[model samples]
Target: MGIPRALLVLCIATAFLSLGPRGSLGRSHLHKRQQSHGRRGNGGHRLQSPVDSPADPPAAGTSTTVTPSNSSSDSSVFDVRSFGAVGDGVTDDTEAFRSAWRAACSVESATLSVPSDGVFMITSTIFPGPCQPGLVFQVDGVVMPPDGPQCWPKSDSKHQWLVFYQLEGMTLRGEGTIEGNGEDWWSLPCKPHRGPHGSTLPGSCDSPVLIRFFMSCNLTVRDLRIENSPQFHIKFDACEDVHIEGLSINSPAFSPNTDGVHIENTRSVTIYNSMISNGDDCISIGPGCSDVDIQNVTCGPGHGISIGSLGMHNSEACVSNVSVKNAVIRNSDNGVRIKTWQGGMGSVSDISFDTVYMENVRNCIIIDQYYCSNKGYCQNQSSAVYVSGVTYANIKGTYDVRSPPMHFACSDTLPCTNITMSEVELLPHEGELVDDPFCWNAYGVMRTVTIPPIPCLQDGQPESLQEIPNLGC
Candidate 1:
């Protein structure tokens, strides 16, 4: 017998409910449920689940999912554009960037992508983090600051811009640009581009560093372009285990204090395969640095790689185990230098500069122990930072005719010792006469024949070491 209509309808409804939704309909129902629960998308205006959930970990090499702001439903990448960011280069995207960083940094093994094809204008912002492991900050667009110093807010931090503070296991890598727009800052009356006959200004004259990482560790910054900073382009302070490669740093040759990369109190750093051209030192290694390796660098239109200017203001410094090899420095002020001020105590040892080629450089190889650049008078003191075990080998260069090719102006009381030079040659570029290498209170041995002659360096350790405490070769 045929079932009654009501009974048949009831049976079909029961079967459908027992079996649940299938295929496309099931997926659609789940999507709607996630939407109702306020899940956000990961990338490109798509929907995604909340990052705080105990979701399944991503597969090997797969990007971890993050729920971006605005709850865009569809993808698993956290795109900054979805979070109320107008990339028109005018609107302030600072808030959006901070929000994105917050959301992205919350999840373990996530990526925060900055989309391309537009310029993102951000004011001075700090991305502070003790974020999860494997966090990737991928930038594929132009991240520019305000027009110049005139547009900067008075209350903003004058010491730093774009700071990544206290972050670990972070990677900042991409094919993008970070523009400082520092024309106005450079033109200030106190800067090198001093206004109106280089007159000094009385007001606060401090400028911000473009990118700084302070008290952070295990960081990797690669494949990026940083340009036109008001002060130092990239600075790492009190950080450790950093790797910086494939970078391009550009600024005006006359812009003051625009050091390409300045590191202080940092260790285990490797800076390789980079190009740096700025007003100040291409790579400035400050005190408390060790185990640093810099190679395959192209530096010009700036001061060459430098160690110290340490022991300044009567402070002690200890630096060791630095190696710079396979570098080309052209039209620079100094090729390889180790400078320390008087009235301080410490040691700089186990340093080597090898296979360096210089062109038209002034003071190709120098060791200035009495480094006094300030206007104040510095009294002669027996205390000094001891310089020893420094080897300069395979250094071939053409120096400017104005200054001596090699200068070693060691301390009078605490003379530098154990300095070695091998296969070094420096010829004058402009004139026929080559200036002599001046040596004062420096004791070392020459390994081979040197151009322009370095016969001034004495043999064996200096007798002054017996008088100074904790001093040796």
Candidate 2:
């Protein structure tokens, strides 16, 4: 893959690269809950969640105590304070947390508690699991790392901060907050807005990604509040059967690259009812992802939900069977986007954006075949990631007049086909101006009358059907 894709998808990089074997860590009694699958007009059916579903996470910002299920509450409790954590906000509490986890992991149905009241400061840490049975990582107190880049250990990776590896049948929910002290990292001269005139900074320019889960299955993260990450807030990479709900991810509008939730090389994921106000993409779907369902998310002061930004470095990328519905996007850079670099090789298909309300959003609905994160991340090439079977339905709201409400800037050589738009009534300048939408090499049908009427879409299929092989995960 290319360097741009490598920026986010590269194993969080170097400091810890060994994945010797999947540990025999954790598992709880499994259960399932039915959730709505698709948007309107499809007569959506309910889909059952993947096996591992313990009790729900605590509501965001609430101080609800978590108790282990089917186990004596007192006996199964493993408290960090009891393990010698001072919790005074400045002391190093990493060992205490590790001790608590060890005790909790030894027992079946145990809860590791970072109870309410203390501000636990710890360094970059990894909690590797496969423990006994089910385990709960309860965070009702404030958890943060050392203040800045200078405080970070050179021996530790700048790419990862708090990581959970090989954990299954686990629930990480709490009213408490996981604060990412990202300001200094964001201030590095190498960062976008911080770069000096034609000058480069010394040392590593990487910032720690806050809270990541790798090679885990049947995971649940809900009702949590994460803020000001040096990078992404919550990322699930190479994980399966995941469900994320009721999260509030926040950062300054200008905070660099603080994506709310990102998933890559993962499958069967569900993100529901989350409120994210950040600086970058509210949620990004990277390569090798499928069967994703996102609903009732409120995103703003950030870039909207996106797919790909893929196939960079002339690599094969595939994403399919994704749906985003009942979402509210406001004051964001883009509404719902499908982006790929010029020379990308795979395909993006079977995507839907339904019943999304946009308010003053720029590039309300867009497909950019020539996507570049920075000024020159990727150079133009003839080959492109094929895009097809995309639907934009019932998307209504006011939009920023600076850019086109709906833009389909497909590849010059490989046009986007099966691009259907229905009941999309976006009016520029706060529901008043009727600017014409833009389209280039995009072919599809408009089910009903669009607000400004898109007369630029071509009326047939492309001749590249055989070019896109189904690369399902």
Q: Per model, how many backbone clashes are there?
A: 11, 5
lDDT (0-100) at residue 260 of candidate 2? 95
Instruction: Give each prediction's root-mean-square deviation over alpha carbons.
Output: 9.0, 18.3
Model 1, range 422-472, lDDT digits (tens) per residue? 999888878885747899999898999888788899999887677546743
lDDT on C-alpha atoms for all candidate structures: 0.80, 0.81
Clashing pairs in 2: 24-130, 25-130, 25-131, 26-130, 26-131
**Candidate 2 lowest-lDDT run of ten:** 33-42
User: Could you estimate the TM-score for every candidate?
Assistant: 0.83, 0.82
Model 2 TM-score relative to the real fold: 0.82
- Deviation in Å, model 2, residue 96 alpha carbon: 0.6
